[model samples]
Target: MGLTLQFIPYLEIEGLSSIGRIRKLLNAVKENKIVLLEGRLRKEEETELIKTTMEEINSEFKGIELAVIYPESQNMAFFRKAKQHFINMLLGDRQGLTIVGPASVVKEIKKDPNKIQLFTTDVKVKAKRPSKKKKNKG
Candidate 1:
């Protein structure tokens, strides 16, 4: 199966309740699409998402791989860090990226303070064997 990526802007989920956000993200992963959310989920929401995913796991759905990439405030200068905090306080969780994908396709998600690497399973395609024709002996 081909991989699909869905990019969701923060405005798309800005008004959704925590449960609603979780449902939307899970539904996309269930459909085999990797979700690229513009912002990270809250701590409680992240916990709830994992809990809900665990509950919904089945034979067909193996669950999900989630990763978040955000700027490290400690590495920033004090003034910049303070500014970031103020911005976050006013703008909500709009300072980072969130990635969610189905475990069936996504093998692993490696994240560092500044980077993310997504490894996937290669979907093997079967090749058809060519048939040989017999020559007539005259």
Candidate 2:
């Protein structure tokens, strides 16, 4: 039996300049291995970008799933509200596992039995700072 999984893409849009990144994201979705997409859409273009991505993915992966993390514009909340309806739209009442974070997402995709994968040109940066050197006091 094929395992059902949720593929969430965690993207960071600095400003109104993520159009190229969005296109690359949609292109990745077209590969048909992704079950769901979960990411923060912080710009006005995000909705449209997601719509277009869904359409493209559907064309290839028929019945492709999409779960988005759309935070309220005014409140600046951090994933507090769960849109259960969106999960229903994709998994059809089934509780799917969420592949969060950049590394986890890549690991999940690589482990899928279907073996569908998406490639991107963008690079992910680690948020942690390098360890400081300890001074030797003689």
lDDT of each: 0.91, 0.41
Q: What residue pairs clash in candidate 1, if any at all?
A: none
Best-matching candidate per lDDT: 1
Which residues of candidate 1, in runs, are more than 4 Å off? 130-138
- List model 1 lDDT by residue over 17-102, tens digit each: 99999999999999999999998888999999999999999999999999999877777999998888798778778878999999
Candidate 2: deviation at residue 54, Å?
Answer: 7.3
Quote each prediction's TM-score: 0.89, 0.31
- RMSD per candidate (Å) reads 1.8, 16.1
Error of 1 at 125 (Å): 1.1
Q: Which ten residues in a row have the lowest lDDT in candidate 2?
A: 96-105
